[model samples]
Target: MIDKSNQQSFQRLRLNLRQLEVFVATARGGSTRAAADRIARSQSAASTSLADLEAALGVELFDRIGRRLLLNESGRALLPKAQALIDQAADVQALFTDEYAAPLRVAASFTIGEYLLPSLVAQWTQLHPKSQIQLRIGNTSEVVAAVAGLDVDVGFIEGAQTHSDLVTRPWLADEMVIVAAPTHPLAGRLATAGQLADATWVLREHGSGTRQIADEWLLKHLGQVRVGFELGSTEAIKRVVAASDGLGCLSRHAVTQSVADGHLVELQTRLPKATRKLAIVLHREKRLGHATRDFLAHCSGVKQ
Candidate 1:
């Protein structure tokens, strides 16, 4: 004999997707604010959902010490089950609703994430009002890895290269430009090879598409430049470049506002137009489900 009493205790239990989502986010974030940001939910809503989950489970999923919430033993045990349920439920819902109910998991590199995907996601939401979009933003390599790891349904990357295991299709055209603070010396005139090579450059960290492109295009034109800093964030690089004499190479889209605001200046260069095609990639091993296919078709239509 088994313990029927334990099973009977949950006879009246009702657990919704929102609660599971909140729980999983809370666990992954280790803080309510990060979790709320991740899921795009209001802090109050996140907190309430977490509280509701704890109440329903009759156990505290997290231990509150000071303002921080740490997952306790019970939470550790429940996290995997909650994640599995969420993933399985999303798939099942897609099957039943012909993909309308399917949740979308999208990953994008920094340039696309900051400049493009938000608008695209807004447009996507307009068409499928009930669609749930979960987006992850990272560097190009990270986006490719996410696709390979099956962490995302689709990935957008601006790298000149992609993983062999992914199907790649060019999505958009992007131009990389060199930028500096308004007061920098090279901002107003064409930069000499020596000046370009001698200047301090704040560039993206290795494994980033922007950095790879710069390495391939800019570095060859101007001999090795002095690396002032290596940062993982494009926004941070922009801010740093705008605040100092350090020059940075970034997508033109990223520096548009800064240049217009007189905070950053787009530098003139003699090098061939450093343009690259932004690409959408899908894992070779995964067949496109209806939700994925629909999103792909939408991208194609929108681009066309």
Candidate 2:
């Protein structure tokens, strides 16, 4: 049913999945050997496939710097397309196997990854038992970078962090609470601005989303406070605050259990309630695979 010109155009397709696979692996791993190791092929074969792909496309996709093969402008432009194609092909293969296809790569900030996602991920896995999900945990800034750099299919983060290359949607509402050990002087009474400003605090480190919000809230309410310990892990901050007389400001979800167990007490402060928005982030051009779309819908409580 095709015309001569259309038939000829169809016949001119020279790109193959194997070549694209090798190209993507090389771009991610930065070497032919690494790509070969990923795809279970010889180094020479990987190199040849990459070379053939470039020759067919009539452009160099990578710039060789010493021994590393970094993606050039052309390669960067083609990577998302190649990744999408590979994922779609896997989906096709999974059709006959009765399994979900394509590994879902997700990144999340501390609070969401620690307190929120575990239950959600468990529920998702119950529905899609054969699906594979990989999660990377970092602070909000790192989560934004991962999504923007195309290293993850989607990201969940806390706070109002935004990037030009990502689309962010508000996912959940969270509250920040100030806590202290049960025996701490301020634990049983309302904290005055002067007392809060004079107290020693154990807080999250500088770059974390919790720290950013805590800084803004505390500084607005009680000028400057003495930071006794700056820890990276929220659990560590909780433990340190419980053992010492210092206080911690953290997500309510993170501290509720401890407060209920009587290990930590929520401080009754005069400061206004501190609330933050947790968000979902994704690269602007990244195509969502079936599993990812389902997971997002599940998180959003959308019946899709």
lDDT of 1 by residue, 200-295 (tens): 999999989999998888778886869999999999999999889999999987888888988888998788888888899989988888877888
RMSD in angstroms between candidate 2 and the native structure over all alpha carbons? 13.3
lDDT leader: 2
lDDT of 2: 0.90
Kindly report which residue stretches of model 2 are placed more than 4 angstroms away from their true locations once superposed.
Answer: 1-92, 95-99, 302-304
TM-score of each: 0.68, 0.68
> Worst ten-residue run, lDDT, model 2?
94-103
Off by over 4 Å in 1: 1-95
- Predictions in order: lDDT: 0.87, 0.90
Whole-model lDDT, model 1: 0.87
